[model samples]
Target: MGKVTLITGASRGIGYALALEMHMRGHHVIALARSEDKLQALKAECNDNRMECAVVDLGQPAQVDQFISALVDRGYTISHMINNAGALVNKPFGEISASELRHVYEVNVFSVFELIQKAMSVFADDIHVVNISSMGGFQGAQKFPGLSAYSSSKAAVASLTECLQEEFGEKGWSFNVLCLGAVQTEMLAEAFPGFKAPVNPSEMSTFIADFTEGAQKFIRGKVLPISSTTP
Candidate 1:
């Protein structure tokens, strides 16, 4: 078996593309998502047994626990993790409900922490962790009108990446955040309908695949923003 990569939200968009790319490059990919049928399709499309998948809603602690239990039972060892799952709510600060804020953070930030805590059991030496964030969360960037909850949740992800790198770097682990700009995907279409994104999911996934494939030593602890303005 090749080095194992654990990728969240792997049923579609950038997550799906990344899973396929990593598998093509000979990594054993553990794809996690809420949609079992979609994940099964991804696995079949790969046409390789190297892709493993689990269906779980990352926002729920109970589901996360079950997923972890299964992972442990299988004795899977992980060399890299892509915390790609996220929840976005596009409500103005005053209009956003408390529950909405909580849900956003639950999936975007807390679930990542829980996954990392659980995956320590199988983490390889010199492990790399990539936390996906958004350029909307970039400190002092031009603020969008209705993204307070989503932006803050992603900001928290960036903060966790920095803190984790400092806490774990000496132990041969690295953590980084990809604070991505607009990418064309279903999520983007839902979040910003009719707005054309310069970068497609496949294009962005190729870049992310390189980072997860061990570009960490050079760029650890960084929150790199990526985008192309081309329409």
Candidate 2:
């Protein structure tokens, strides 16, 4: 078996594209998502011997436990992990509910931690972790009114990425924080429809998978103007 890559939210959009790219590159793609049917379809389309699926809800502890248990039972070892599962809610800061905030953190930040915990069990000497932060991660960025919850969660993740970088870099484990601008994804379309950012998610996925190969490197940024305006 080739090196295994664990990708959360791999059923569609960026995660899905990333999985396909890696799978085509001869890497074992371990797809995880809430939609088993979608993952199944993806597996069938790729038909690559390295492609596999594990239905998981990044926000739920029970689901993650079950998925990891199955992987271990099957002697699966994960080498690369992209904590990409996330959801966005647009509401006034004062109107956002405590439950809603918890839900966002559960998937965006918490799930990444749990998956890393599980990944350590089957870690190789060289491992790369890419945490998908947002342009809002940078200090002094305009977080906007409705996205207080999401922007805050992404910021917290960026901070966590820094801590991880310092702690793990010395040991040769690398973690990078990728702050993306608007990309052509369902979530992006819903978030900002009329003016879509020029960053194509499919291309972004390809860049990320190709960039993250070996060694632990720390790349941090905030408010990356990823729109075509720059390029």
Which portions of model 1 show Cα errors greater than 4 Å?
none
**For candidate 1, lDDT tens digit of each residue in 1-231?**
559999999988999999999998989999999999999999998787799888988877888888878878988778989999988887677999989889999999899998898778878888999999988777866667778888888888999889988888888888999888889988787678799887888889999999888788688898887655421
Error of 2 at 220 (Å): 9.1
Give the alpha carbon lDDT tens digit for every residue of 6-57 in model 2. Answer: 8888888889988888888778989999998999988998986789887777
Evaluate residue 119 in candidate 2 and report its C-alpha lDDT on the 0 to 100 scale: 66
Top-TM-score candidate index: 1
Compute the lDDT for candidate 1. Answer: 0.86
Q: How far is candidate 2 from the true structure (C-alpha RMSD, Å)?
A: 2.7
